[model samples]
Target: MRVRGDDLVKDLKKLRKGRGILTSSIISHVGPALGEADCPLSDRELEILRMVEEDRTATDIAYALHLSAGTVRNYISSAMTKLDARNRAHAVRIARDQGWI
Candidate 1:
């Protein structure tokens, strides 16, 4: 079975957290590296934004991602709010500029 990158990352984080002292030591050394790797937007937000960058409609993106169109729109709206974008196009542009997608 194929696990998504987001799921794998979350699983690794869970495993690291279970290690207590080791995780703390690693976090101390890792510092900003971990912070930088953490996306300001959630995985679903990034995925939908990237699709927008490809000029896909909300319906198209929803179909591709196996989500409802409304759900996809909500994610896009949330991403726009987080990025302070004027619209979906602007959000995609900002995300691309930040290398978020």
Candidate 2:
């Protein structure tokens, strides 16, 4: 059966409430690199990066953005390559350093 969006939201809220903890590691990790110097990010790339900064999983981002996980992965990979980043964490750091996200 298909679940409605409201139902999904309610379920998510319930799960979050059960967890009873809101962490702040995402900002902490990306804060230092917020301003340095590098290339600029496009609007779509920035959106994807922001979602990444929010600590959302690739699968979650894909679902939220109505994209295939493969597509999300490709965007991430392309971003990483353009930034000459070694990995996801490095890409985020580079993007933040460039003031792209």
lDDT of each: 0.71, 0.66
Question: Which candidate comes out best when scored by lDDT?
Answer: 1
- Which candidate gets the maximum TM-score versus the true structure? 1
lDDT of 2 by residue, 1-101 (tens): 23466755565565577852211222233334574343445676778878888999999999999999898888888777666567777778767754667
Model 1's C-alpha root-mean-square deviation from the true structure amounts to: 12.0
- Itemize residue pairs with steric clashes in candidate 2: none
Return the lDDT, model 2, position 96. Answer: 74
The lowest-lDDT stretch of 10 consecutive residues in candidate 2 is 20-29
Q: Write the per-residue lDDT of candidate 1 for residues 57-96, one digit (tens) a residue.
A: 9999989989999999999999877765678887777667
User: How high is the lDDT of residue 4 in model 1?
Assistant: 60
Q: Candidate 2: list runs displaced more than 4 Å.
A: 1-40
Clashing pairs in 1: none
**RMSD to native for every prediction?**
12.0, 15.1
Q: List runs of model 1 lying over 4 Å from the truth.
A: 1-38
